[model samples]
Target: MTLSRRHLIAAAPLLGLTAPAVAQDAPLRFAVGPFQPTAGDTRRAYEPFFVHLAASLGRPYRLTVTADWAGIAVALATEQLDGAWMGPWGLGTR
Candidate 1:
């Protein structure tokens, strides 16, 4: 879904850390921050969690590793990310 900038901003809060409303078959866009030194490392570390979400949600997903801690929030705000694994600080982005 192509979200307008206005809609993206408006829905940021409502979306939380989960995906925007989408078809079950639509690939959910999951994001990871710079918790690890490298994007590959981060993706590897979070692989199992993504597997779990895939199994539980019964849907496909794509992962994005942000270059910095704040990139996750930026991705969310721009509607580039659908789901994310974040801590307290990410919550403040709203």
Candidate 2:
């Protein structure tokens, strides 16, 4: 099975809701897709964003940057990316 399906299946037990349904949880990893990291500057610049998000959500957050378009596609398709910025062709919806 694909990684996406596997992740969903593994998370099935935690998918149930309480009395009132609401998505108040935070994502563990924030994946930035298909972006070129300039001498590790991306990590330094965006690390604070992850830190702030984690602090606000009371959970740990990690920033993940995929190397190139293909990498991003693979990550997206495999569900390794929680949130990403994809270009027009990166989505592979053609």
Which structure among the candidates has the greatest lDDT?
A: 1
> Runs in model 1 with CA error above 4 Å?
1-22, 88-94
lDDT of 1 by residue, 30-69 (tens): 7877778788898899878767655455567788777876
> Number of the top candidate by TM-score?
1
- Quickly count the clashes in candidate 2: 0
Q: Candidate 2 — which residues are off by over 4 angstroms? A: 1-27, 33-39, 85-94
TM-score of each: 0.66, 0.49
Q: After superposition, how far is residue 73 of candidate 1 from its true place, in Å?
A: 1.2
lDDT of 2 by residue, 5-84 (tens): 34533442343212122134545555555344572775676567557544544555567766666765676567564444
Least accurate 10 contiguous residues by lDDT in model 2: 15-24
RMSD of each: 8.9, 10.9
**Clashing residue pairs for model 2:** none
